[model samples]
Target: MKVVCSYCHRLLRESPGEAVGVSHGMCPECDAYFAKLWGGLKLGEYLDLLPVPVMVVDGGGRVVAASERLADVLHRPRAELRGLRCGEAMACSRSRLPGGCGKAEHCRECTIRRTVDEVHETGRSVAGARAWVKTDAGRVPVTISARPAQGFVEVTLDEPEALAGALGGHAPPSRR
Candidate 1:
C-alpha cells in the first residue's frame, strides 16, 4: 500500500508486496512540527498561533475565541471580541441596532453569517467568498472563509488593500 502524509500530502513509502492504494498518515516531519506547535495548546491558544485573522464561532454566531490578528484587524481587544456576535466584533454598523447583531433585518443577508451558518449546518467549507461589510468606517470589502471545526465553525477574514490605511499603511499578513 502507498502511505502519504495526511498533513502535507508528502509520500512516505509504498509497501513492496501490498496493493497499490493510498493510505493517509502523518509524516515524521509533520508529526514533529505539529506536536511542537500544538501538542499541549488549547483551541484558543492554537487560534492565536495562526498567522491570519481567525475566529471560532458557536452555532448561535457568538465568537467563542479569536486570534490576536483578528482583534488587531477589527481594532478591538481580544477580550472584548469573545462572546460577541461576529458582526459586532467586526463593528458592523447594523450590529448596534435596537435588536443587535444577528437580530438586525439586514443580517439575514450577511455573507459572513451565512457562511458560518452553512458550514455549521452542512459540515462543509466555504472558501474565499467575497463580501462587503457595512462598518462604522463605511463599507469594506473582505474575503471570507469558513470551515466546520469540531462543534464550532472557524472563520477567517482577508482584507486586501481596503484595510491598509487603517493598519497604518502595512498590509495584513498573507494567509499563506
Candidate 2:
C-alpha cells in the first residue's frame, strides 16, 4: 500500500503486508510548509502550531486565545476573537438568541460546547467529535477535537476533506 499526503496527494511512502504498518508521513514539500508555519512556537504560546483552526478556551467556554488558522477561518483578526464566548467567537447561529452561548436552548446538544464542558468537568481530552455550525451558506460540518493543556481546553477544528482520507473515506456529516 502507498501512503500519501492528504493535502498534496503526493506519495509519502509504501508498505506491504500489514496495513497497520503503513507509516503516515508527509512529502517534503508539505513537511516544509508545515515546518515553516508551525516550527519554534511553544504549545502554550501558540496553538497556531497546528495546521487546523484552533481555539483555547476556559472552563466556561470563553475564548482565551486562538490560532492564526482560526483567524483565517473566521475572517477576523485574532484580537477580535479574544474574550468572546466559544459559540460567539465561532458565531454558532444559536449564539444569536437572547440567552447567548451556553445559555442557549440548542447549546446543550452542541458537540463543541458539550466536549468543552466534559473536558472541564473530567479533565479528560476528547478526539474526533463531530459538530455542525450554522453558517450563512448553510450548516457546515466539522470534526472538533479537544484536549486539556496548559490550563485551557485546546480545541482543534478539521474540515471534512482533511479527515476523509484518514478516516477511510467516511466523511463527517455534510453541510445541509
Candidate 3:
C-alpha cells in the first residue's frame, strides 16, 4: 500500500500497509518528533485542577452539567441535579416575602429569570450577575458569570458578599 509522508509531502510504499513516517520511512524517530510537536500530554490533569464550580446550562437555564462543589451548596448528590429546572432546583418555589407570599407568588417574575435571555440578547458573555436563589432556609443572594462552552452555555455562582468585597464594594447588610 502507499501512504503519504508527513515531512516529504510525497507518497511512499508500505509493506502490508504499515504507515509511513516523516518524508522518509516509518521510524520511531519520526513518530516521536510528531507527537512532541503536537500533543496534549497533560490535558486530563489540567481539567482536574480547576477549583471553581463549573456548570453547563441550557438556553432555558436548566442545569446540564455541574461540578461536585455545586452538590455541597444544594445539599444533594450532583447527579440529582441533572435535568431539573433551575428555578425548581434552587428552591425558589418555597421562598416567602414580607407578606408571607411564597415563591409561588412571584418567582416567575424575578429578574434573574432574565439572565440567559440577557446573554442571548447582547450576543456576549455576562459577568457579575446578582441573582436571588431561594433555599430551604430562605432567599439567598448569588453572583453569576456566564459564557458559552462546548456548544452549550456555562454559568458559575459565587457568594454575593464575597464577590462584592472582592470588587471593593460592600454587601448590603442583611435586612433580616
Candidate 4:
C-alpha cells in the first residue's frame, strides 16, 4: 500500500509488484500531491511572483532561498539570511529562538512556523496560511504558504505590509 509519511506526510509509491493486494494502479493522487508540493516550493528562476517575502529550505529545513520579502519580515539582510540555519535565520539570535515567539519553545506555537513544519512532515504543500504575529503595536495577521524548494522548503509571506508594516516601516530598493 502507498503509505503517507507521518513525519513529512509524503506519499510512498508502491511498485506493481509491491501493489499486490494493497493499492490498485499507480497512485496518481500521491503523484500529484508530490508535484504541487515540490513546485510550489521551488524558487528564484521558475516563478515570477509578487514582492511577498519568501524563504526556502532543504529537506533538513535549512534556509536555501530567501526573497526580498523574507528579509523584510525577519528584519535582516537578504544576503545574511542565505545559507543560515532555518531556526537561526528566522529567529535571528538566541532571543528570537525557542520561546521567542510564544509560550511554547522552538516556535512550534507560532502558526507560521507550525505550517512550515506541517508541510515538511507531509512532503506536501501548505497553502493559505494566515497568522496573527505578535508585534509591538499588537497582533497582526499575515498570509503565508509552504512547499518543497528543490532540496529545501519554500515559504512566502503575504500581505505582511498591511498588518505589520509598522514593525519594519519600509523596504529599500533591490537592483535584482
**Best-fitting candidate, scored by TM-score:** 1
TM-score of each: 0.75, 0.65, 0.53, 0.54
lDDT (C-alpha) at residue 69 in model 1: 79
Off by over 4 Å in 3: 1-49, 94-108, 160-176
How accurate locally is residue 94 in candidate 4, as Cα lDDT from 0 to 100?
A: 36
lDDT of 3 by residue, 1-176 (tens): 45555574455655664654433454455667567546654422322233554466676667777765554455556778777656654555443443231235564565555666566455578888887765554566777777766555666665535433433344443322
lDDT for each candidate structure: 0.83, 0.74, 0.56, 0.60
Ranking by lDDT: 1, 2, 4, 3
Residue-pair clashes per candidate: 0, 0, 1, 12
**Model 4: number of backbone collisions:** 12
Error of 4 at 29 (Å): 37
Model 1 alpha-carbon drift over 4 Å, by segment: 1-38, 160-171
Worst 10 residues of 1 by lDDT: 160-169
Off by over 4 Å in 4: 1-51, 59-61, 72-75, 83-106, 171-176
Could you tell me the lDDT of residue 56 within candidate 4? 77
Model 1 residue 102 lDDT?
79
Q: C-alpha displacement of 98 in model 2, angstroms?
A: 1.0
lDDT of 1 by residue, 80-122 (tens): 9999998888777899988998788998998888888899999
Residue-by-residue lDDT tens digits, candidate 2, 12-128: 777666565434557888888678667665543456645667888999999988876676666568889998988777656788888999898898888889999998888899999
Which of the predicted structures, 2 or 3, would earn the higher lDDT when compared with the native?
2
